[model samples]
Target: MDHNHQDPSTGLLTKEFAEGLGQFMAFASNQETTLQMGKMYCPCPICQNRRFGTVRGVWKHLYSRGFMAGYKVWYSHGETDLMVNFGSISQQNNLDEVGEQQGGVDEHIGNVQMVEDRFRVEEPKFEAQIFFDMLDAAKTPLYDGCRDGISPMSSATRMMSIKTDYNLSEDCVDAIADFVKDILPEDNLSPATYYEIHVSGLGLPYQMIDVCIDNCMIYWRRDVVRTSCRFCGKPRFQETRGKSKIPYKIMWYLPITDRLKRLYQSKHTAEAMRWHGEHESNREISHPSDAKAWKHFQSMYPSFAFERRNVYLGLSSDGFNLFGRHRRQYSLWPVIVTPYNLPPSLCMKREFLFLTILVPGPEHPKRSLDVFLQPLIYELKMLWDYGVEVYDIASKENFMMRAVLMWTINDFPAYGMLSG
Candidate 1:
């Protein structure tokens, strides 16, 4: 069961490798033509199967570079995940139990599963090629003499940061990309578009719930088929030339379960999600978990609090002026939720903040704002009453994960609206 084939102290191969290599090659050879290119995936310590090699080249690597540690399952080599019991292995190496994983999920997940194949890809053509392509791009340096941290990953992400800071249009991305292209070599990206690169694993589900023109009740749940708002009796649909009835107003809603599970999908974020329980702290209020509110809630609901993985979240919303002070024609209201489970340093980060609902307006819906929150409250109730099954990459198992809205944060006037 011990898959550590190389002795870390000496950087030498263990005796077990000599006997195991034959069996390993036999398995790889059988699956190679079907799952990979002509060359088999090299399991050498240096390449770590991130590089492919000819059978002979791979054998040479195995001899010289050494075998990577804890790869007993061979999931990368087209082995079925069900073949080996990963749960048992993960239990033996839980983040709480191991000294090796102290740094966080990113560093820990690299050893377990890298980006491209982090989640399982079933198609062969999809799996074999993408595994190496993304891995290469992720590791590639933007330019020579660049620091290890300042590479393509950093370069492109910085470009993304610029776009976000300015709230630039999609049209502007091409201009920025062209400038970077003139500088660095053509990276392993599709000329088709960079949407795939920008949002690879970040695609979450959303809904376009119909809203009344007067912003009374959202046409949701049992009211979806209704032609008018229940409270105000305002028309739900607008007249059209054809038979189609377009909604007078629409509210954008993003679901939370997938977003929560996605936190556990990444190697680093998964571990960070558990920081509320694991991080060392003092009596002086550092994280929300250390505060009186969290302790008081825990005292009342010990059963819910006992499960550290059950997420607690903060929902916050505020109105932003979309136009200049001279032309204050529009405002945008975004309802964002942040997990209380991450350590103080990460839980409140902009990247960790998820926008679950978008309310558009010529004016803020001061009184009717709660009507827009109907979908979110309904979903949160479902999450609390009946937990959802989520896969934990760090633990390598499925667990019933529940979430509760710990509190709401807003400006004074906005608080009056939400509080009422």
Candidate 2:
């Protein structure tokens, strides 16, 4: 059989894979093979939704068609690649540049090399040291505007307080920016630009998913294709605050896979994550990783413990009142994903806790937790079944990462909802 050059789950293609497909398609067209345009050309048995806007369509077609169908189509048409083989998923190593077989030992070696080349992403070239160096060079002029020796961060602090804490309008930002510039003329950066620089690579950006106001279902994946809530028939976007414009609710999806990948992206964080394993301690008390439950679980499931780098996460959630001392309080639920891979001292830190899901509400879904947690459940199920491909910074190689939702920590009220 043959394999498609696309990710099975996402149908994402590399530039190299897309270009190769384009060349093969051009070759087939030259040989008088009739090619259909748009979605009509897709050979997938499950779907016919491929569009001709870009290579993404080609990726979708190849992925949906699967190995067997795509192979039959290529072989029957007598299409060939002088430098490639499609007979097997592992054929990336079977042939040399001229499509000829190498030796058995050489094939194994080549396979490993090919896997590394395909998955290994070099560390980002931008160094934090460079950023600090630039800051050091600008420090003198940054503090030059100080009359009575006010700190430079004072201006930034005031700006953040006004924008985030006070929830000021956009028009206020320009005036704040002007005031900050007057104080530090050398660093005359706008508030927006400064914010971008500060948060450029702090964490993985989140995805927004539309959710039903009734807490019945979230419009994600296949559900997203529809305009209205499947369960309640309510419009995906609802009028709120006595206005006819704003969306009623949205679920912010920050996946565990993406968050773990960001940990590997930074050299410092990658090393820091190994502190639990590397620390020298013979005393009875320290980190949660040192506890009996943690050790026993690892002993029971030795496979999970084989890779010390594999992450263990804890789930937590609670409902809180967004408005205090009000006639009608807005109830908001936030689901927090905590990485237990960090040392005990840092594991529970505010900065390390990732807000994976933010359930907006004027009222909490007390008993309807499962319905609202549909998207998270789906992601967890997929992670357990297929796992995620992640780079192992400690080893400087790629590995399949499988994270366990070790435990759930919630209040008594939330416990019943989450457990039920």
Candidate 3:
């Protein structure tokens, strides 16, 4: 008969269909919270120090605190398994610490430095595979449709691919090495300027984001020459032009105006006033007129709104060109930056971290590396807010990885300092 018919309001269906639909809705609504409950038992030192007697207790505590409350839960078997592995490692480390403290003879005073050193010796390396697993677990099933051994695209991979394609060269393998040599800060090749590179172009842009330069060496050198984009397939070398020379700098200013507009639009005038009051009372303001000046700026720039978007930097040996315009492959460097010092309310909080990489372009009478690197200034500001201590740059090329590791550890003074 005519089974497709349905009521307008309820959209009437057969009893079986209605029941099935109800089941689906319930599953969808509770999915995230349910999955969060399953994998909330993290064994990190931060969680372990909470005096939870067991792993299960930690999980329960996280749930009670609503750590993942209202967050959409995405499940990945690999991620859950990885979390378990990390938790086990953390637990073992904790046990080791207890053993060290208890076994010491001679009524010993607890050496804080020794304890700190032991912890660093035990800390797990941040593996890309683990990160990929985390991202997978965080993504929903509907979006995780790839086959076995394949996971979803990441922000890192996508940016790298875009950058690679924009600067495609048959000699990219060789070019990157030369590029690294040219950007070396001084000739010391210290760890401060280490970097890495990756190339991919087969997937969706955003999903392909991944770090190419994990760690590489940087050395001191002043005479290195930048190369033009050979991917453009033209004999003429072209340099990056205009505001494009520093895309990051132009985008940085946009967020400031954008934040002010949002504050005005949300009618957070009283909160704004309170912030000013707090600023004055706390002496957070550099000058007495700073508060008034801020309010005035907000009032005048009511339409100011910063659109947070990804900024990709691609250099063509030929010149910068959009992806579809060229037939030949070019090497592209996708530089991603977040607007600096965004209001706390607009930040990702726990996961917000910023990184910047500098790639020198071929020197030409027309373009300057000074202009090229200017955009990164704003990115540096954002990184500061996130307490980023380490920078992985590849310019002068030695000890890049070690420097990054040191920075990651020492930069957050609250966590303790990194030693050479």
Give model 1's TM-score versus the native structure: 0.56
Alpha-carbon TM-score of each model against the true structure: 0.56, 0.55, 0.20
lDDT of 1 by residue, 31-87 (tens): 634233446556666556544456655655565445677777876565656755543
Residue-by-residue lDDT tens digits, candidate 2, 212-330: 77877877777877767787888877556775655567777777677676575456677677666556668665777878888788878755564456678889999888887787878
Superior candidate under TM-score, 1 versus 3: 1
By summed lDDT, the worst window of 10 consecutive residues in model 2 runs over: 98-107
| Model 1 segments more than 4 A misplaced | 1-201
Q: For residues 266-343, what per-residue lDDT tens digits would candidate 3 score against the true structure?
A: 232313312322233353544322445444643453222110111111111122423457675433322323222223
Clashes of 1: 3
Global Cα lDDT for candidate 3: 0.28
Cα deviation at 244, candidate 1, in Å, is 3.3
Worst 10 residues of 1 by lDDT: 99-108
Number of the top candidate by lDDT? Answer: 1
Tell me the alpha-carbon RMSD of every candidate. 14.5, 16.5, 26.1
